[model samples]
Target: MDSFPLGVAPHSAVTIRFVEALPDPSPVIAEIIGGGRSPGRADRYCAGPWGLTVVVGLAADATPAQAAKAGALAAAALIGEAIEEAVCAIALSTEASVAFARAFRARLFRPLSLKRAPRAEDLCRLGALTLVAAKPKDAARAWAPWQAIAEGTEWARSLCAEPGNRLNPTTFARILGGLGDLGVEVEVLDAAAMAREGLNLHLAVGRGSATPPCVVVLRWRGGENDAAPSLLVGKGITFDAGGICLKRAAHMEDMRGDMAGAAAVAGAIRALALLKSPVNVTAVLALAENMPGSRAQRPGDVWLGHAGKTVEVIDTDAEGRLVLADALSWGCATQKPRQVAALSTLTYAIMAALGSHYAGLFATDDNLASALLSSGEASGDRLWRMPFTPADDPALKSEIADLRNCPPVGPPDAMNAAGFLRVFVPEDIPFAHLDIAAMTLKAEADDTLPAGPTGFGVACLVLWLMAKG
Candidate 1:
């Protein structure tokens, strides 16, 4: 009888457990009185977010004083349980959790911890049982599903927060290689392998870094009957220094989070595996670190991509698109997925345009654009569709090579980057480019979810995959 209940209880007494030892008696009171709005019982109640303890009433037809006592105890026990779950799940060191519980009045609200703390079982338990009285069944069932999503999102954020030295290209490859054991077929394409395949643009960007670049393909085939898989490609710059067109050191610490898109894709695959969905999903991640070394590719360098298309490197800072160009081509060529979606922190132009509230999606095909827009909305990771017609494609044309890595610098940089990626997508194929630079790591205090390495795209992608059929 560890679980709590929603709706009205007929009993007079309730009990809850406080799992952590406490230094002080921080009490929370939730007053839910009046069986169907009786005069003597209190009308409203308040308690700390998910605190512990339960109150007792002298039956459903109790007096005001009896109901009050019941409410107080119930609120305390319930709030205590919530606090216990929150602190335990955050796996905070005992001292930190103790301090945090006291400061926040652990008998009340459950705040998310800073790191992967205690087991997520409490979260799963909380989610499993929580339900609005008016919509009990549906609400209760919704909990476990979204709880799983939250778990995956947290994993993705952790990946982004990790330092470059610990999780570079080779390590990333090895990590993804393990997914093969989970029914994901992984292919790691290193610098030499990519060069042999004529992926010169992807190599040019990695040339500046000490760690070699690698393109990783993770394919999950749950669709035993399906003919074509859905493809997702992510720009995985383990670190970005903007190469020859170097970025200022100020705020460059955030560059480690540049690989947020790749982390997101990896997390999405993990979610799909957890959910055991029926869709065939393929994830491609191009892992590299953009560094400014003597061997770094300079501006004005030209290189060939996978589809035999040459690109002029006008700004080595635009390396995300360069690596993604090869990834996009590789995905389209090998998988020939029914649909292709690529994501990257390609430009600040998106932030300048749409800010942090939404991702900018550029699609060559209208149906794919519509599908992504709808899916993004449903998952709470919204995307605003941008135009990418042939007229807009002209901006990326170069006099030196088949195309320039960047477009005429201006207002529509995000859209132009999408148009650039579209150049490599087969004409008849459907494709969408997601500019996630702004939405990935941005956060706010009042957000439904906290800031710092927001795993923004993983949910939307999983939802998209789930809805594909």
Candidate 2:
């Protein structure tokens, strides 16, 4: 986690002067504001009293997202200049000022960099953040939740940023073990434990890899001991080589981020612990590496899941739901939580439907769906609700098994995958499935984060859990 030295700066610190609603520059910004017509935009200038200064502007109707972007642009300009400490001179609302402060975290977007040299223009590469606001205390108050959310988001992104070689199943579980230090009771179930518990579907996926798979359960008991907890399940496929059904060599490297869903769950748990929120959460992460090794499970193989349901493997590439099925079943049956939500980098079908901007959401409960939708809006990790297919759906039928992992031929793979998972959970519990296929990696930076891993579900999950309280 990257640390921002809040409210600490030297007298000669660099200045990021934000001129909100600027028509003609006043004496405050005249020396620094270059020729830029629009407000809520970054201007072109450096070399002020402190050495390097970047001036920005904001409009009356500007959003916090806009504020962050503007601040990011300013921060990007100061990246390689070696300007150590800086004060944010912004005359905006408390929300906007806090958003402005978002530009300075060391690990916002560039999650993990094995790159031997420094990056060119990552905004999070900035040094210090001291917000000069109308009411410093008010700004601090507004920044608190966002800071926690940002920390969670950065944690998830860093996990996603790791390459497959560096983040195999064992290493991944080891990395998450550190969360136990944060008061989140973390338990890892290796292959033997999972196999004993009838997690066959999950074990099958990792049979190909030398680094055996595991299931990590994190419990954060912030609420009463007797309180019914909310459950989160993540499909942690550290690397998806598509098993025997191999993917094309082109862009196959991007599959290293397939475990983003698990990363998000861990990140959310970390955030809740940081806030010390009065809510209980049990997160079940199904960790595996799907490789096409000699011992890999072949197509047409059937596995008896944790819930005693048999699923025929139609396509090796559709392995996410297989792991998730046992995870959802084990988590729901063990914890017996109030509500349940599962996330995965599931299918290309959902991505084709919602694009990279929004995850495909499938839910059984209206309230859960509504809360998630609202959280997506508030947290900027958007979701579009999609219908979950039924168990009796003709495409899911199999000759020898209870169901097929995926349809032999399909356009609605996402819907079928969600339905397969829903069969494992008890009917009374509210359930939601987030198919976050294409949102994790990006070719370029967006309003909130830089390119690479966007930390798909953390911020939204944290805010949703907070609202649950």
Candidate 3:
């Protein structure tokens, strides 16, 4: 069997041994399997001679998603045991190999070790991941796409792992600005520029914070210069303190991950540029920090957005749509894209509806919605389409403004939030809103994700962009 090196490094090193119905088995492996269970199960055993061995079984006809999840679970199982060498392999095809590589590397991601440690092991460790490929051609074919996925997923997760103190608006723009090195053009419009350009609603959300807000524009021109690209607008609330309407004392720290959507957008464009895909893509990240201060907008306040529409703030915490509304209008007017997709951890109502199993997708047209759902299935980051229009719930209407940020009374808030955003997107352009509330952070380790932030939409967006190919 030939071993191929996955281009990316994992946080922890782990050795995964792939075995089939081969007759020549080592004595230790044989002994362990003698008492082990069936296929698709992963078990770790301590052999007196071989040290720690993680044995993962693969079915003959496993799909790419199954193979990917199995690889992640197996890699995670080996991390705590401190086994580093060769990772999991099953002589996978190019697609399965790419899937396995993306999930395995994501599972190895952990919080960065910022503080100095007395021991080497105390810091986060990066190890090699070796995948078994049947032929050199297959390995070469899978290399670039796998690297793209790994880089994108890890980038988003690392951003999520950052603390709010270190990742405010200015610093966030600086970090995204570095994407220029990857051959993407990055431009950041500061508060003064945004205010001059009539992004008042975006600015109002950050009024309480000393760190000024900004809009980050990233352009990757892999297609023709005149070709129309798809625009991705992300709500980049670096920290959500729930503004004047404070959140519960408990679990408020989870707000540090409020920027996962922005991270994922940048990451997806990073992948597109890295892969040199034949598609143009534009990303507009609405960066801010929602904090409580004397200057912050209170409930029932109205602010005009870039689209020349006034939004009434029913709850200060419903700031995602506020930022997104302005960003969407600004991006559509400036970039002139064929379609729009906005990603945000916008509502708790989404989690209440779909839980963490899927992200809520609301689109203007059935064809666009079906395409995104297909991409989600192909990528393993599933999306559930919501049958919601602004007219579905009349409560989203505002008494004093053109739009209401949230409904004051009973209704599905997630649907209403997406419905509110529908006004910003033009009828000529197809629009999809991804409400990724429940899918961003995972409370426990799973088959395809670690115990923290899962880079949920990176895969979905990548697949969707490349689907035309």
Candidate 4:
């Protein structure tokens, strides 16, 4: 759990400038484009001869959101593969300029590299980028919150990107323990400890994995009073081999990202702690590794969860909900939180329905759901609320068990998975389930993000927490 520097600290690898309009093109840019004029809004140009590459042009009519996204796009164009020193020139208001710079720095950030051998050019890199505002002094204050959010997001992405061998359930717990430095109280519940408390469903899911399963509880008490904290439960399947219902060979390699939800929870808490937000929050990360072995839970097996609810396992591949059920129930019953929100890459149905553009959100409380939606929009971690009705519950009913992990026949499978988890959440508490199957990773580099873990929920959760404050 090596600590990486937070945000894009001032250095010499990259340079970014925000302006109302593009500056005069560099001689090299001019030569490359045959002495053409500067680029228009949302356009960029690279000048290698000037020892710099720059992204130019931001539309005058662009909204603050668009400007932020443009800034990310610009920065993404220059990180890693491109020249280390880069500039972002935009013509906008001081506030908009600050917003652009914040986003540019966030997108330009790279997580700690685990590469054992690296090129000499990449060794001892000290690249830094600057954000020049129309009013530099005023804009300086505006970058703080965004910088904190970026640090948290990058931290989560680094954890998610770590190899399974390096970041198992035990190592994950150890890594989160680092947050104790920020006043976050960290607790780890091992397999025997959880079993003693009747967390059968959660433990059963990881029975086959040598890495074992655990529950990580991170408590951040920054509020004034002892009111109930907001409880966040994350599914931390460090690696998913699909158990006995093994997945096809096509993209099984990506299973390492199954723990992305836990990473998001950790990231959100880190951001809140770094910002010193006056909100009490508890994050319950249900960590496990779903692998195929003689000890693995088989299909049709039934296990009682922490809440004394029985879940019949219909498909071993749908193991996230099993782990989350125990965490949600345990968090609610023990912590007595005012609200509960669970994040997980729980269902492929979500990806099939919403694609990579949005996460599927299912909530029992309208206000909480609305707040999350608003946060998602503002944070660029978009969520589409999926329909959930009493009608969807019938699919989860089982003849022997209280509920089935996956119904042989159901309303869209994602909703069924949500329905299964809903049974674990107490009716009196507000609960929201975020199925981020499509939001975890990208197939290709986009304007604002690289082709890897996106750290989608960190900013959204932080914004929601801030709004609550």
Best by TM-score: 2
lDDT tens digits by residue: candidate 4, 266-378: 99999999999999999999999999988999998999889988889988999998999999999999998999999999998898889988999999999999999999998
Q: What lDDT is reached at residue 154 by model 2?
A: 75
RMSD of 4: 4.0
User: Order of all candidates by TM-score, from best down to worst?
Assistant: 2, 3, 4, 1
lDDT tens digits, residue span 305-327, model 3: 99998889998888998999999
For candidate 4, the lDDT comes to 0.80
TM-score of 2: 0.90
Give one digit per residue, the lDDT tens place, for model 2 in 194-241: 989999999999989988999999999999999999999998999999
- Candidate ordering by lDDT (highest first): 4, 2, 3, 1
TM-score of model number 1 = 0.74
Assess every candidate by TM-score: 0.74, 0.90, 0.89, 0.89
Q: How high is the CA lDDT of each candidate model?
A: 0.67, 0.79, 0.79, 0.80
Q: What's the number of clashes in each of the models?
A: 30, 1, 0, 8
Cα RMSD, each candidate: 11.5, 5.0, 5.5, 4.0
Model 3: colliding residue pairs: none
